[model samples]
Target: MVSFIGMIKRNMLVYLKDRQAVIFSMITPIIVFVLYILFLRGTFVDALEKYLESAKGLIDEKDIDVFANMLLLSGVIGSSVITVSYSSLVTIVADRQAKIDYDISATPVTRVKIIVCYLIAAFINSFLISAILLTGGLIIVSLLGNTYLSFINVLALYGITLLGSLSATTILMILVLFFKTTNSAGAFQGLLCAAVGFIIGAYIPISQFITPIQTICNLFPGSHITALYRNVLLNGVIENMNSSMNGLDNGSLATTLKEVFSLNLNMFDNYIMVNGMLWYVIVIIIVALIAIAILFNKLYKRK
Candidate 1:
């Protein structure tokens, strides 16, 4: 166990020294988030207003605030998923290319220990990427004039992101173990991550896609993670609102915006938070175990 920890620590140290990797994992996510926000600012505001009226008095005066917070959190989670999968797969492939697996195999260390060390290292990378994205997101939000930040929401977002990122990384690790070749792992991981990103609405508005595609996407960890953010951010939607109805009847974006920005409380409670985070952890564990079994089989067959 101690040796495994040492291995993970060593990999982390190496990761810190890799400036290119650091930038790709940390900087790229924030940049992408900023760009995405800039491009979708209008749509976001419109959606926020429309959704606010749907909640009625159930949520008061906090639609814009909640929407902004949710957007930032979702960006952090999405970026972390990308960062973890990219780093974990690329690093493992590089190690395999260098024959590090055989070197470790020839040593006293067990394959299980080696795999655990890899996972730990990947988790560390994922965690750091998440932290950086969160901090960067907060700065962006602050600069954009959103002062009503909820630390509790931030904490929930972080927990969900961490689990989601780890889950995606674990799946990639399975691919690495199964394929063995650096080229195979790299190609598969890149393509899979891109596909998952689209399916999860990370890079595109995947939710706007057809129901069948969306249903298929739900099977992926990325989709679930993003859905958690969407649920929290867009919880208790206002549906629509008309001014003549005194905020009681739903009507349109303009009316909903007028009503939504006037609230002070959240539309949805903690239930969504509990469910979303629980789902990530449960799914991650199940996937990780299955991945380990697959890796063991591959290794056995190779031997």
Candidate 2:
């Protein structure tokens, strides 16, 4: 146990030694947040009006803003997953390439501990990174004077994003343990961050996608985490509401006779808090198991 603790500390210290390590995981989110605020300004209302027109409804403008906020928050939380996954992968690959991983295995370390060390180090980094990003995001919202920020909501956002980061760690470990080459690891991480990270509506709003694409987007862990953020920050809860014709267009009788039936929207209620936490636990266990398995296999390697 002492050795395990020592290994975790050592790995964390080593990770801190790299300047880029801190920037990607820690600095990049803030940079993205600033960029988003700048780019989305003066256009949010225009965009909302367009979405309202497409919804084919007489819904309240505030309701539209509320829904839009949820989508944006989800993207914000998704960005954290990118940072956690890529930065950890890069460090793990670097350690292996330098033969430090083999050196550690030569000691009295067990396979479980070897993997645990990396996870511990990653978790510590995740906690700090998630906390900072969440706080910064809330601050940005508050500064805009257009949104509310409460402690409970902030904590929920943190929990959801942390789970996403934990789940993403599994992919990072799998890449590092098997790829074994630093260049391959770097390239793979780059592709994932581009394809799976910022583009997948994790950093951008998934609501931008049509229904079919949005359905597919739900599969990504980052999407769910971002949903949690929206529920907490914007809705103050996650509820599962059945599809209702509440927001449907109610035009003049002549228009109504046209029989332009509107699509039913499924309303997810305050159940987001419960379901989101459930997802967090499930993702954590599954990712932990995968990371453990990979670490054990690598630990016993004869090289």
Among the numbered candidates, top lDDT falls to 1
Reference-based lDDT, each prediction: 0.58, 0.56
Native-referenced Cα lDDT, model 2: 0.56
- TM-score of each model, paired residue for residue: 0.73, 0.73
Encode model 1's per-residue lDDT on 70-170: one tens digit a residue: 55556556656756555655666676668776676777876677777777787777777776766676576567544444677667667766777677667
Predicted structure 2, TM vs. truth? 0.73
lDDT of 1: 0.58
For residues 1-303, could you state the per-residue lDDT of candidate 2 as single tens digits?
A: 787888788777766777776665644455455655676423444654553454444444544454444444455556666566567656667777888877877877776777778877876776666677667756755654445446676666677666666766665566566666778876765566556544444344554455566555555555555555554554431111111224243423212211111111112311133464456547655865776686658544645
The 10-residue segment of model 1 with minimum total lDDT is 262-271
Worst ten in a row by lDDT for model 2? 257-266
